[model samples]
Target: MSHPIHALYANLSARADRPALSDGDTVVTHGELIALVERAAADLAARGLGPRDRIGLCAANSWRHVVAYLAILRAGAVWTPLNPRNGPSLNGEFQRRAGLSLTLHDAASVGSLGSTARPLPLEAWLDGLADGVPPPIHDDPAAPFALKFTGGSTGVPKGVVQSQASGAAALASLSAFYDFTADDVNLAVAPLTHGSSHYILPVLAAGGAHVLLPTPDRAAILSELKSRVSVTFLPPTLIALLMAEADFAPADFPRLRHVTYSAAPMSPARIEQAIARFGPVLSTLYGQTEAPMTVTGLSPAEMTDPALRASVGRLFPGTPVAVLTASGVAGHGEGEVLVGGDLARTEYLDAPELTAASRHEGWLKTGDLGRLDKDGLLTLIGRSKDLIITGGYNVYPAEVEAALTAHPAVREACAFALPDEVWGERLEAAVAVDAPFADDAALKAFVRDAIGPVRTPKRLHLMPALPRNPVGKVVRGDVRDLLYPVDPQPLEALR
Candidate 1:
């Protein structure tokens, strides 16, 4: 089978003059994109970088970044993305872990990369189209294609070893699930180093245009959706931000067909509000860094049902998914979510023990606690590690968060655990609100009524905003650290 990059090259060649990537002010045609990729690929080969060699890309989302990525693949080297939003120390650690030989970076990210990486200007890759093409390399399904690290929410990030087969499967699945067409234009609102990058291959393979927004600016995103965009991917946090924009409305997005959300679950209440604001374009998929976002999908049509809206969706066709309890698979109940398919990452690089522990029964243990209904629809409860046990009762943070977000005053909520002397672990929550809601006791009562006293958060605090990771996922750990500082608040203040 041909590599996904080779297939992408064929598609690019066929389209020629059709616009491939746009940065609002600039447009790169398919023909132009190929020429850039060919030149950059040839340059890499001349520099002695070849198959299996890791090349780091640290840059913001742009037409050039996309070209550089494609060129890295075309040259048969492994693509390793270093998110610009990450701290220098974190990126440095990732650089050392991945053992990247050379890093291609834009001006904005050059300072963030570690000194260990041989940083090259991304713009300088295409010195000129080479005299002859680089020597052809054989496609190997199991060869490393990309080196993406997991989001370090739980602990230290681990390098996920993604095979070429896994990357191809992700590309194919996204295209099949979304039904991308030539007319489809994908507005990349999220960072390309993250989830937004997954949509690029599918859109490109279908001969569609990719519009790059430098940042996830709500105003810029609104402008694009109002005009050229037909499809886009955003985290639920960002969707909430857009809704908060004074002018946000369904009528503004005439061309939008798919508004895909993932990274974190949006509360059912927020999802309903989104449906009203964005029309039926609100769709979502559930997957982690290990799986690369194609496990299961809920289409816009399926989202119309309020009950199904609570679910992440049914498993994607041909993808293996199960809910595993302590004993075995829970065919129609709640347990740890497991995935086994080509789309799942092969293993963690340089961490055999970690890899083995992460796998269960020949499947990748997703670390997500969820339920599989008789209908095959999966509803994620929370992360296994995030589950809080208070007074001998298990409390899913997501449940409490969902209830809090359902309140009109609350904009977004994050529930987490605090060590308690009485209860094994006490459930406490922080919320970002749209309106003044100083009555913490009343808010606690509201959540208690929604679920029950055991499941509801014992304490609720209003925050200006919740702590989020670079990709906009609310990090519960960070939220805890922020709320309870080293100095600690007085007991009276806590009450």
Candidate 2:
């Protein structure tokens, strides 16, 4: 059996003249990209990197970054992604944990790795084009392919070990579900190491072009949508910003086909506006680092229905999903979402105890709280750790945030708990608004009407924007810190 990379390379080889990848400053055709990958792979092998070796890639998004990624796989080494924006300390932490023997870095990030990584410039890998074909890769479905990490929002991020089978399944599922075509041009605005990279193989397999944008720029994205881009991924926060643009309109983007969102849930109200502004092209998928993005997907056709607006969509064709309740019963109703099958990762690197707890009876236990409808549509409630207990009533912050964002005035909202004398943990929220609205009382009333008083925020504050991590997830911890400050104050005194 040939490796998945071998199959992808074979596909690219046949489409020699077709455009494969490009940044604003560089471009490579299918044939040229494959040649670079082959040579780079040879170069890596010559340096003694091979199977079971963890190779770290720390760089910004670019054509070279893409080439290095494919080349690393071709060399039969495990690819470990280190986001440059994550800064030196976090990247160093991951490096120490993964025990990376070598790290490939861009010119910009070479200094950020400090002394922890055995850093080499990414350009050095591609320098020897005459390096010849890479050695044949051993076909092992269970072989570790990539090491991905969690967001570390709750605590320290764990390294999720992804097998070759899981990666192939993810690419296949995404490719089939999105229905990519040869004419498709995917605009990659998210980090290639994260969500954006999932679309790479699928698009390439279809002989489609990838337009790489190092950063998500609304103007450039709009420009691409008006012309060449057919498919792209945007987190909910970016989508909200795009919709807020004065000149943005659905009619301008006639060629745009799919605008997928994930990372964080979009408010149902915002989802409605997105559909209205971008047509039926809006889609979403729900998955974490362990399972990747193939677990469930909401197709463009499904977004048109108001009833399923809050749903992440039905499970992918071959994926297995179940909901486990608080009492540890797995069934068809509300509880913690569990996943099984080829797409799920089985372990965290070197952490047997943590890995053991993350699974139940052969299924990977997702820390997410969700409920599966009778038809298999999954509606996420929130993270199990994010559940806020106020007045002895369990209130998921996602529910409260959704309610707050549903009001027309709000653009983004974050719901969190504050220590309180009476309620144990009082629900408090902050929102970034589009247009100026009435005071906190009016917004609080709107949330109260939507989700009832028990879930409604006790105190609402308005900010220009909510703080988000590099990957665009709203940082709830930062919100609390901003509201209360460092020295700490009594809740009554702060209020």
Candidate 3:
């Protein structure tokens, strides 16, 4: 069977004159893209990289990054794309973990990694491979193909191993769901290291044009929408910022057919605003790094429905989602969401215990506390680990945070459990405000009015900004540290 890369190459070969990828003025035609991939594959093969060998890719979203990714796959090696801003330490860490023999990176990143590990500059690598013959595809469908890392709420990044079959399955599902055609232009704004951003592969697979946007500039994105692009993927934070900007107009995106958001939950208000402005073009997907594209989704039409505003839509095709309870496994009424499908990653890199705990039988425990409504719509309550046990009562931080954010003055809020002598664990909130408050008393009073005394935060800390990972997930451990300082009175003896 031909590898996924071969399928992409076939499209390029058939449509040599058509645009395959673009980043500003740098446009690589389908023929050019294939040539680059082939040459890179040859160069990689010369370096002793063969089927199933791991190749680390550390670079931003650009033509070079795209070529490097395709080359790695064409050479039958697993592509391990790391965040360019993750720094050299992470590169070294991934190299060791993935057993990467070679790394392809941008010049600046190569300099940062130092002489101890001389990674090939992307430009030089491509130049050397430009004239080389295309290497025959040799990918094993069952072998691991990519290791994409996602940071948990705790801020520690874990690699999710995806086999070639799983990756192809996800792409096929996306292609079918979106009705992606060869003429469709998919934008790459999110970091390519992310599975969500890796939508480029599917877009290419469907013979669509992959528009590479290196920077996530709102104005540039708006301008691109005004141009030939039809599909774009953005995180909720970016969407929120775009809507708030006075320069952005609803008519700016005339050709935009679909706008998808992932990585974080979008506010209902924002979703409504997007629907009102963009005309039901908003799509929301809920998934984790362990199983990137498995969970539920909210379609464009559902965005306009008031009743379905809280739902993340239904499961994707070929995926099965079940709700589990203490009694055993139950039908999808209301329980912890568990997902099983070909798209699910079977293991975590170098973490067997975590893999065993996370993946039970065939289903992967999502760790997200969600319930399937009677309509079969998935409603995310909060993360299981983010659950706060206070004075024998269970409190979901997302619920409290959502309530707190509902306040007019509150811009954003995060709630976590903090140590307390009186209650064992007390609910604390860290809020980002639009304006300064008089004191904690005023803030507490405001929260009390919104959520009542039981849900009121024990203490509220005013923060200018929240520490988040590269993908925009809040670092809960850092937030906890900010909320609770190091110096504290010793807790009373348990006796």
Model 3: per-residue Cα lDDT at residue 19: 86
Error of 1 at 429 (Å): 0.8
Model 3 whole-model lDDT (C-alpha atoms): 0.74
RMSD list, candidates in order: 3.1, 2.7, 2.9
Cα lDDT tens digits, model 3, 1-495, are: 535665675455557878889988988888878777787788888888878787888877888988898888888888888776666676567677777777788875664352224367888877665366656777667788787776656556777787876777666667766778788998888877775455766777667888887778888777787788888888877877777664555577777888988776665556767777766688877777666664677777777787777667787867778877777566566657888876675578889898889865678888877778656688887777776777777778877876766555565678877667777777888887667887878778766886677778888888766667655777766787765667254322321
lDDT of 1 by residue, 11-128 (tens): 5656888898999789998788777777788888889998999999999999988988988888899899989888688888899988998899988887788665588887665444
The TM-score of predicted model 3 comes to: 0.91
TM-score of each: 0.94, 0.95, 0.91
TM-score of 2: 0.95
Error of 2 at 321 (Å): 0.3
lDDT of 1: 0.83
lDDT of each: 0.83, 0.83, 0.74
Kindly report which residue stretches of model 3 are placed more than 4 angstroms away from their true locations once superposed.
1-3, 10-14, 111-118, 435-452, 487-495
Superposition error at 265 for model 3 (Å): 1.2
